[model samples]
Target: MSTFAKAGFKSANYNSFRPHYPPSFYKILTEYIGKEAGKTGDKVGKTIDLGCGTGVATYPLLQFSQNVVGLDLSPPMIETANSLKAAKLKELGIQDESRIEFGVCAVEDFDAPPNSYDLITAAECIHWFKDYPKFFEAAAKHLKPNGVLAYWFYVDPVVVNFEGPHNEKLLAIETMRRAQQIYLLYVYEDPKGLGVHWDRPGRDILRNLLREVDAQIPQDLFKDVKTQKYVPSVDGLLQLTPQDLRLVREKITLKDFTNYISTYSLFHNYSESTGAGAEFLEKMIQEFETELGWDREKTLLDLNWTSGYTFMRKSGE
Candidate 1:
């Protein structure tokens, strides 16, 4: 079984705590699709969101395509995705039930007609594919002429001192970094010389991010390759002033932060293997709280994260 399929994988927590792609990210995708639609004199057609865990990227995609298919290898992940479809659709004012579908299948094995999709997306999950060239070939096979293929992953967050006293914020950020290093050592380092083999694709992707994406996608098969970096401010229009940043901080709680950390595949795997994941996490959290002088009951962490994407059009447009 895959690490994502391991018992205790909390799909709900993953959905709740995972960082969402900003609205601007979705806007850019829709604008690209709209421009392509204009060239064809037809609205955007079908889409497939590869590795659409808990429908994070899949749900946002509904606005751009007539239908979307979210595919993942883990049954529980698919189940959680399907469970949210109706509510999300309703929330989005979508009346059609046929607009979205979730399936338990790896992208390699999922069947689709050639030239069927107008857009294909694999957000934060493409790095897990065992065969990049094969996956790219499959993607090309499924994309229509001029179709768009977009995928992206985020590196570690860029924490900023958005609030609190200047000295306290600096101290907190430093302590957070130290806590992270300790957690990484416990999870990734084979401490105690136990020869623990840590070969998780998700973990590798987290460490390498876009480098893995570049290594996987065949450059010859696509055209008009492009990329965009998403930060707290894009083009200075979305800049978060100190006050705005404070508002952003208010949305997250300590529980939300911990829940997000728990969703990492490394934590799940570590927990399953050694039964010490929770203890390790608790110790790390305590250390961070102590170092930052944060009250666990009231402190909210301000996580300043950045992300980016690379996209290309199918050749022969």
Candidate 2:
């Protein structure tokens, strides 16, 4: 992992080119908001995108409201996000410029006025927050009555519908899991912060955070859809280059694949782990290569995923 001073793929090309959250994902949020607006007879007010990495979630916020503010701890990430536009915007020749304002400040320190916002959306970055209670408190205070606080994410390389081989799916899922783990901790610079803990490590932390958030969850608003499949195996995940989208491809395990598991920073983080971790990853990669038997170029790799979401809204009060 890069030092605390270094940023991860959060500011890298992957973020620039990777898939944005599915339209349906935003559709779901908008539907929820519309329902709220209908009952309250008022549209959702201004929104804030906390940790809006490249504003991937910001574009979707347009579906519910036009006024949105995106906050992030990394200036570079925010810069990248602020300049990025929804892919569909270009495709449809429709440009909604200035719907989001990108700022470099941790939400913990961002002192916006209370009850100022109608919706707050924190995508993949919420888990990295150090103080969930403070964040929610501030978010709740900023949100007006019936305001919605939403954090969600999506994966790329949409790999669920493939039927190539079991190993392909296994490797893709494991690779995605490990890479996404970067946010839990060690994702940011060492001193800067770590992830909430991707699965286990992060899960324990999320479990505790959820306990506090449970009370604030709007009965119809809180939705933790953990099943968003947004992370794909990087073309270079195992040091394997990305493959062109070809339906019905071949496969292979680690033995037949690259010897450079060094390409994986997840393993690099464990260099001090008595060499056991390295050996284990090597074995796992090799086993995957062997089982797949589809090593066409032995250099090209495909990533798959089973995507879902975790969401929460304030219960109707």
Candidate 3:
């Protein structure tokens, strides 16, 4: 993720790409924040989102607070977020229009007016912070007395059931897997030659951080979080004739796989950075064109499992 930003492609990709958090998730947040409001007598409090690219989390927080601030280092992202049309805002349930605000600033550089905020959220943005301990301490400073901090993230689910042999279904699963593998290779190769792209924390890290910071919550974010099984809807995408996927281990070529990899981010980035990324893809396509030598059009994808988890709290009265 940091590599993407370092490459000057953060906002470029963020504005057009990225998935929207489901409204169901926000409704749950509203309930939790409302609970805090009842105890503190703060009807609608100030909420801040750190590293809020395009305000994905900020726009959703509007239901829980009258004033929400989205701060990100990307100015272009801030601009794009502010100009979203009324229909777009309507989709986010942001009718008040003035409830949301976005700005260009790094979270570390921010100095909070003591106890001025009721809630703060860092959605998919915490990993980019340099000193996380200091960052959380700053978060603690901003809380309006016992204020809540929430973290939320998600990943695309992995598919396991598609693992048998070479049927149409198996072929589809294989295709997705191969694409993912190439993607991993592309990123791991240091496309932009940036420093390490920090790995995202899991439940264990979250627990350790909360403990180190002495932060407590009523609910365990991961207690109920479980990996939802992946059932491949492979029948939908492939337009190949019955003959293509019918035989056991029927051959396919590199060109076939490149088509799918092109749908991925790393492919695009690699194409831009390596200059030969497209040529490399073309080479793969040509290599796989022949079905005679050994096996062909072989695909295996890395099915990733992603989950969403959250825990919230209310500020002191």
Pick out the ten consecutive residues of candidate 2 with the lowest summed lDDT: 240-249
Number of the top candidate by TM-score? Answer: 1
Instruction: List, in order, the clash count of every candidate structure.
Output: 0, 54, 13
| Predicted candidate 1 versus true structure: per-residue lDDT over 120-222, tens digit per residue | 9998887677777888898899999889999877644433433332226555546555545544554456463112534556556656646776765676788
Clashes of 1: 0
Candidate 3 Cα outliers beyond 4 Å, as residue runs: 1-13, 34-43, 85-87, 92-95, 156-183, 186-272, 276-305, 310-317
lDDT of 1: 0.69
For candidate 3, the per-residue lDDT at 259 reads 53
Lowest summed lDDT window (length 10), candidate 3: 242-251
Which runs in model 1 stand beyond 4 Å of their true positions?
Answer: 35-43, 162-198, 229-251
- Candidate 1 vs candidate 3: the TM-score winner is 1
Best by lDDT: 1
Question: Tens digits of per-residue lDDT for model 3 on 1-317?
Answer: 33333434445446443445655555555555555322324446788888787776677666557688888776666776677636557885556767677787887789868888887888755545666557656766677755777666543323232332233433554555554444344434444421122243432343233232234332222122111112223332422231111111112233333454453344545566676665766554443333212122353322222333344443345
Clashes counted in candidate 3 amount to 13
C-alpha displacement of 65 in model 1, angstroms?
Answer: 0.6
Candidate 2 vs candidate 3: the lDDT winner is 3
The Cα error of candidate 1 at residue 142, in Å, is: 0.6
Best first by lDDT, ranked: 1, 3, 2
